[model samples]
Target: MIRSVTMARAVAAALLLLAGAVRADAGATFRAQFGDAFLDRYWALQPDAAIAVGYYRYAARIAVPDAAYRARRLAFLERSIAALRRLPEAGMDAAMRTDGAVLLSQLEQERWSLAEFREWQWNPSLYNVADAFALLLNTPYAPEAERLRTVSQRLTQVPAYYAAARAAIARPVREQVQLAMQQSQGTLDVFGEALERQLAGSALRADERARFLQRLRAARVAVEGYIAFLEALDQRLARDGGGRDFRIGRAAYERLFGYAIQTGVTPDALHARALQEKERLHERMAELADHLWPKYFPDQAPPPERVARIGQLIARLSDNHATPAGFYDEVQALIPRLEDCVRTHQLVDLDPSRPLAVRVTPPYQRGVAMASVNAPGPYDATAKTYFNVTPLDAFTPAQADSFLREYNHWLLQILVIHEAVPGHYVQLVYANKTPSRIKSVFGNGPMIEGWAVYSERMMLESGWDPSPEMELMYSKWLLRVVCNTLLDYGVHVRGMQEDEALRLLRDEAFQSETEARGKWRRAQLSYVQLASYFAGFSAIYDFRESLKQQLGERFDLKKFNDRFLSYGSAPVAVITPLIGAADVSR
Candidate 1:
């Protein structure tokens, strides 16, 4: 017994020595040393972001982060990066290495945005803090009175935040200025209409409610003042300077590509690739049009111009859209069908019990995204994922038709696939399951959006109602994806003006005038974001193909997909190595 004790102690001592030796060989694993503190600092700097991500610890305290605060945040990032650089990758496993890479990429992107782009000086949208305040009311993370305290506190700071915003504007973009003004109007409604009614009905003390109402009135005045300032800025710029160019320039755009597209491909390369795909997609669309020409127009001959032919084919499909009143119901009715199809094919795992609530988009969140998935914040366990479909009730008949045509019956299913089932809603649910909080909050736009677009193509491939009309609609949707990348560069780097963009969408992508016009504004209002849809889908799909080649006959489609998504929404570049490691281990 004594000899056995001695032998066990010797083995334990040797194992401890081995662990120490490994630690001495490498500095420390990233998650072990850097993750928690870094996340804490990130939340501290951007509490609004934390709130959006479902953290409610600071819900009652309104935060109006100013210019000096932003500068300090950038300085903090630099220090974090320097510290992180000293922590070698030697000790990390595949997952830890991936988390470290994501942090580095994120910090660098933010650094570039602050130090170089100086978007605070150029983008008026930065001043739109309404979403932060309004979110308190929209979410159910806290009790009524607790949420109201946040609304009250944030409202009181409205004038101060507006003051900081006004002082910071040096060379604002015209499109962003206009968008801010438009969004400000919606925000006013939030305070005047929504918040007012909310406060009256809530169970807050009389004194608290009275004081909150006073702050709300103050916020109204401040908002109106900001709106007036924007109007004057607009007129001055239009007559004298007309603001700065909306383009982010080639070099800066390429730098942005590094953050947004984790793939090593340059923006120039991506743009060129998009051009090639656009051509091919148009050809596929034309062929589908040829197949359907006789069905749509029994006796008439097909048009000579491919654009005209495709337009006619799309118009025929557009005739099947729901009316303004029934639009929401139609979208809601279509939900179960998509859910049923995804399950029938065993495409991806889903919890039928998981909450996917469909509703009309609030006024503030509308305009940019016709439909968007508001996934539950990473911190919120009980909140449902909202699939916000913008109502057509407010639009003119002509406007409604154009919007409906763009989202026609077949196209509607594709949109739903991209926005809800087996897309953003499903992927985000997977994202929330991951242990890394950083990956969930600072998700790669390319991967988040790319997966959705890829799912649309995958759904069609899985033999979900493989009709020619469906194929044509799907092909046209694919063109929109390609055109999105093309137009982003075109406007931002290629000096693409309004007419050129409109022509590209209508002629090449076969988008209606309504859709094209809305897209033109979206392309201007946003920068490089449009590219993510294509870049993400392309990289992810290519990665799948590579895995297929590597694993050969051993590759299982469902398993491959589930495995790919298991790492949350890390950049595909970061995700690639992990997948390679996983494949090797398997």
Candidate 2:
């Protein structure tokens, strides 16, 4: 007995020593990797750094790359990848290993895609950077002193960034000419607007005002040069099938979809699935529409006239209930109701750490808002959430009516559920607390968007119908998702023209021509992004149902949600592996 006890004690001691060694090694490695990442080339590309450090401390004083800087950037990226590759992956925990692997893969892919794929050679518009600079400077989150300092510095770099941008325009490829043109226009607008804002402000010193004017002139010159280049490029591409051939080809597109989205499904397959789901949603909508609108206008026919009249009546109802003053008021009132719904359904765990609020979209991004929620970035400890609604401006009485009718009490409740409560705000609050920076920063849009859409349907399923009118609105939104998928695939793969795309939007989604046209433009510019929402939502729904069946009595909403969100916002591919399930990838 004495001999056995001694042996057991020795074995236990050895295990403790081994565990201590592992922890020590991991702690050092974690700090080193994080330190390197915080100071590395990745930081150079990030918008927050530009806003927080570049503008304030440096005073927009960085030199523009002239061959040397470009070489340095390329080398830095390569070295970072090589260094990360050399890091020991053996001792890390599952989460750490997953994050490390994903980061390494991302680094390698970015290097290959940008340097070898000649992406920079073809799509060299610095306007994206400029826009990032503009937002960082202008947004309310930044301190005033920081904003002013950064604004001054960025304004200083404007000339150099614009010059580089113009130089890039000199060698435009055929396929990306339209994108290039749009970028050119966008950059000019940014520079012009910034200059106008700076000059108009009373706080600027004489030297600052003069500097702003000088930079403004240079920016204008660059814009003119870019325009000239576009005109020439357009003519050149017109002879070679109008740049249609210049796109991320099938293999490359697939690779990007896999890397960026972490989904194995091809864009075409996803689009097809979106269409299928869309049809299913429309059938549900039609049934609901018939149930509600029959009282207002009784017609049992289920074809063209019924559909058209139903749409007309919805518009008329929206008009009748329109209240110009009540938009904000209505939205505010629904918050408590949404909270109660979540608590009553017990869909998921609500963290006390999570903070949520509703606000108007900033003036600069108002053009893009139907409604949106900006999640706190990876590093933020505070869970700041913004539920931004676009303010109405200069709407005619008829237009106002149409708009207000859509925001009736029940529809407003649905919107609240969709945008706040257990939707984006809730999901993002969980995501913000995730430990993996790589996963948090490179979050899967599909997962984020999919969760929000699923939440909308989940509320409806939970017997909180709000009203039939609201149900109809939800259906209309679902139809839009279907149309969005069709339009995305139609434009990118099937070569659908603008007019044809708009026609489909109007006929299928029941959108006004103005809305359809706007969607068509968005479809042209954004390839396959919309399909992520529907595709993602469908996957979530399936995963939830399957898990419920598999777990049976063990199934707990709070436990499942907490476990799922703890994985962060990685691609479905990575997420599927982490969750130990094949169902989510589908």
Candidate 3:
């Protein structure tokens, strides 16, 4: 029986590899291949992955791949990259050629990065594949059977995944234990959310309810068992060896950052840039703030009392302005207006078929007060875009006032512009419809983020706001972008302490204690991600000006945007060439 089971496992693994090998030579467009292989695989097992791939409906039924499956997937990636490299770029159009190169480069980088995952080193966080799946399953879009299948698959793999995790850790017992505890907490949060959904559903048939309950219980038991396994692993690792750290060394860290983010700059250089930008932005913000609130005080100076009073006023405004429906109404209303504004200004020719919507954040994933747009996948022509706003918790009087003050109406509008209209949503909608699927999938962050950040300034330049209040709000958000860049670099490269980081946030960005704390945690958790916003926006602005000069009267804003977004998402390195050499004619 044991031999037969082992043989079955071996055969299954072989079949998966064989399938991948055959698919590699199928001669499908890179978009179709990625959609069929990578997107489809994760769609049912990891909804967050699906969401990232622009498949919200199947998000609930997706599970993170098992260890064996991950291994096979890696092998398949290698095969696909090999096949892609052989494709002739000579026959392709400029867009296609650019896309192909970017895709190939991204594939190589992804493969190298994935090699670092010797075990389940990234399991506990909300960004993790598992958490993404858990959130998706709770959505109404997923069918029960598919959800069950995904759940069953995840449950069955838990033991083995835990075992692999135990074997891979090269750290001390305490660290392992801490990791396990965090994982357990995250898992419990997910399970609790799932159970709440099931219990609240009055539409469930008796049998369906029973099934959900049974599965929920089973999941709980499995999670507890995995936690126990981790505890045991931690004890063993500690006893066998003194607690050792398992962090990737500097070289590996550098390689991963470069390949994954497509930035050649060192962390140190990035950090220094962030610091300089931060100071510049803070100065700009101070000037703007002083100009905006001149009525409350006489002198054009930074008065401590005035600053404190302004903070109080902001808090009051935020409280008064916050709607229970959150930012959805305001965001939805602004989309069309901004679209019109952009068109009126000849900023970008909007695609009629481009999908865009404002959505409330998923219930299971609240607490984070950030908004973002989920871009469509390379091949998916259905550019279903979501401008997701984090929901406000049912707030106490004090909390409500505090929350409201920071997220005032002007700030909210700016956020809408940044997250929706001419920001991410507009950029991605065009990207999806772009001819090159490969470029869409492998598009660079700097271009995407940079374009969005650049929009903030463009809006102002186009006379969207002339009031000091509006200008201050704009500058404050810019300050955030600056702060994000600084903190990301500082945490990762400069080894800045948390206290220092908090001080910078408070003094420079004017972040509240609560906001500062959250930013501090986010900075520590994510590296070099924040820099993309400022760095990218700066590069994009420079490129746009250079393009305007080159194109002269031919440099239509709408046409430029339409063309820029049409290439899909790719690194600026590849994108810059496609835009052609800067024609100094403006």
Worst 10 residues of 3 by lDDT: 120-129
Better of 2 and 3 by lDDT: 2
Q: Per-residue lDDT for 1-586 in model 2, tens only? A: 9999999999999998998788668757855865445444466654444333222333344445345655766786688787777767666666767777667667777677656655555554333444445545555555654555556556556557546655644344554566556566656666676557755673667776676577667756766676677767788767754343333455655565565555566777877787787678667766776676667667555446556655765664554443777787677777777788778877777766655677766543433336788766555436356788866664666555555655554566667777887788888777766877667665677788778888888888777876777677777777776777677667766778878887777766776655676577666445557667766776777777877777676666666666677777776556655664332232
* Model 1 residue pairs with clashes: 237-242
Off by over 4 Å in 2: 1-31, 34-40, 45-71, 85-90, 116-143, 170-249, 299-340, 343-369, 380-385, 391-416, 576-586
For residue 310, give model 1's deviation from the true position in Å: 2.6
Which residues of candidate 3, in runs, are more than 4 Å off? 1-67, 82-93, 117-119, 126-213, 223-253, 263-269, 286-290, 299-333, 351-355, 367-369, 375-384, 394-400, 580-586
**Candidate order, TM-score descending:** 1, 2, 3
TM-score of 1: 0.93
Which scores higher on TM-score, 1 or 3?
Answer: 1
Report the lDDT of model 2 for residue 352.
62
- Predicted structure with the largest TM-score when compared to the true one: 1
Per residue, candidate 1 scores C-alpha lDDT tens digits across 1-586 of 9999999999999998887776555535555566666676677777777777787666555445477877788898899888777776766556666777788888888888888889988887777666667677878788888889877877777888888888888889998888888888877878877677888899999999999999989988988998999999988989898588888888877778777888777888999999899889788888989989999999999889988898888888889987777878888888888889888988888876567999878776766878998776678845778899888777899999888888888888898899987899989988887877767777999999999999998899899879999999998999999999999989888889999999999888889888999999999888899999999999989988887777777777777678777778888787777666255323
Write down the TM-score of every candidate.
Answer: 0.93, 0.77, 0.74
lDDT by residue for model 3 (1-586), tens? 9999999999999988876665443434544555446545534444455565555556334334456655776786688688677765444445556656676677676677567634344432221234444534543345655555455444444444444554444543344354455556556666676555755554556675576667666766666766676667566666685553333345655665675455445656655776787667556655655555555445544456544544433443344365645555766787888888888888776777765867766443444445777555644446456677765565666555555556677787777888887888888777776665556655677778877888888888887867776776676678788788777666655567888988887766777676687677666444556678876776677777888776778666655566667667776656666665332222
lDDT of each: 0.83, 0.64, 0.62
Residue 77's lDDT within candidate 2 is 69
Which residue window of length 10 is worst by lDDT in model 2? 50-59
How do the candidates rank by lDDT, highest first? 1, 2, 3
